[model samples]
Target: MAEIAVLGAQGQLGRQFLAVLGRRARGLGRAELDLGDADAIERTLRRLRPQVVINAAAFNDVDGAELRRQQALAVNAEGPAELARLARTLGYRLVHFSTDYVFGGDRLRRPRRESDAPAPVNFYGYSKLLGEEAVLGAGAAALVVRVAHLYGGPSWSAGRANLVERFLARARAGQPLVITRGQTLNPTSVRDLVPAVLALLRRRSAGLYHLTGSGPCAAAEFAREACRHAGLCAKIQWISRDPRPARRARYTPLANQRWSQEGLPPMPHWRSSLAEYLLSAQNLPIRD
Candidate 1:
């Protein structure tokens, strides 16, 4: 069994990584391994000596990154660089997660491929792109997986409410909801993502991969689908993307063509995955 260590274990994706890895994995959150601290990360990795280090930790505040550029670069860029260096020295495989925001949606590309040039529209995306560069530059055995519009999996998701949660919350209260229109993305669930990621690791795949739901849809479409699965009859209002505090890319959907060509299994469509997530939430395990 490969010795696996997951950073940011408290996050939605991290928790699912832990659940998937089971006893073969050790999870380290900020308290155990702070990505911002270089010496601390090196020391902990030395002590643990994990054969595979999965960097699920990230400063994922897209809007906040604009204000905290230095903070974002520290955790999102420098942190992954350090991890890559350590992985090289320790002879371990490094798996890092990035975001689909790296691509500028205004470009002609509809669904971004692994080989597409990255032109981030926001500070957060730029930081993650830097992290990818840092990790790849270190020349270690690494895989940089980029994902988008992530939701579902563990209930404890670092205090971030996903699209489904936001829609369901308003629907349950019978309140009117306003969702952005014109903006399109593939809303992905962590449950569908985790197993695919594991398989990639098992196959020792290297380089970058874009993993998300199969199809793209507007944010309003995603909300309506969630409503259908959750059985919520709530009025929804669609609004233009203008007048937002932060500038978001318009149509940044990721394509898994490279992964597919590699003969790996395809990810389920957005609606199917969303339905599974809603069902899973209702069937939590009971403990005596």
Candidate 2:
């Protein structure tokens, strides 16, 4: 069996990766280890000495990160740089997760390929882009998989704000969900993502890749689909604004042909995967 180490085991992506790769790797969360201190992270990796290392930890609060840019950079950029350097020195393969936010400023019509020039808009995107830069600069064996709008877990995880939580928040209160119809991207599911990441571990393909849902849709359509899955029959009122508060990428749905050419499957369309998430969540207690 291949020995692997997973950081951020408590996160949506990390937890999903662990559930999908159970009994096949070693995992750690902030409780067991922290990524803030680069030296500590390196020490943990050195001690484990795993063949594959997955770094899922990140400063993910997009709005909050605007105020705490340095902290975001520390975890997303500086910390990963240290891990990449150490991984290169130790002769181990590394895998890092980034976000679609990396290309928000560019309002392009075509699907953003892995080769597109990165021009991040917000502090969060800037930080993640820096992390990608660090990973490449290390010159180690690593793959940076960029994903968007992931929503799923082993259970009905109802905290820290996911797309599911946002949907549920509106549904339970019988309120109108005013979602943007202009924005578009691959709204990925964590279930689809974890499996692909595990597949990469088996092969360790080193390159930048898009690992997202099959198709792109507006947030309005996505919200309606989510409500349908939640056993709710609520009608949402679509609203248009002059300029949205968030610096959203007009249309950055990713193309995953690269991963497909290597025989790895792309994430299923958001609707299919989301239906599975809601049905599975029926048993878990619905938060009021």
Per-residue lDDT value at 121 in model 2: 81
C-alpha RMSD between model 2 and the true structure: 2.5
lDDT (tens digit, per residue) of candidate 1 on 124-174: 999999999999889999999999988886543467777678777787778
**After superposition, candidate 1 runs with Cα above 4 Å error:** 107-109, 155-158, 281-288
Query: Lowest summed-lDDT stretch of 10 residues in model 2?
Result: 238-247
The candidate scoring highest on TM-score is: 1
For each candidate in turn, the TM-score is 0.93, 0.91
Candidate 2 displacement at residue 22 in angstroms: 1.8
**What's model 1's overall lDDT?**
0.86
Q: Rate the local accuracy (lDDT) of all candidates.
A: 0.86, 0.79
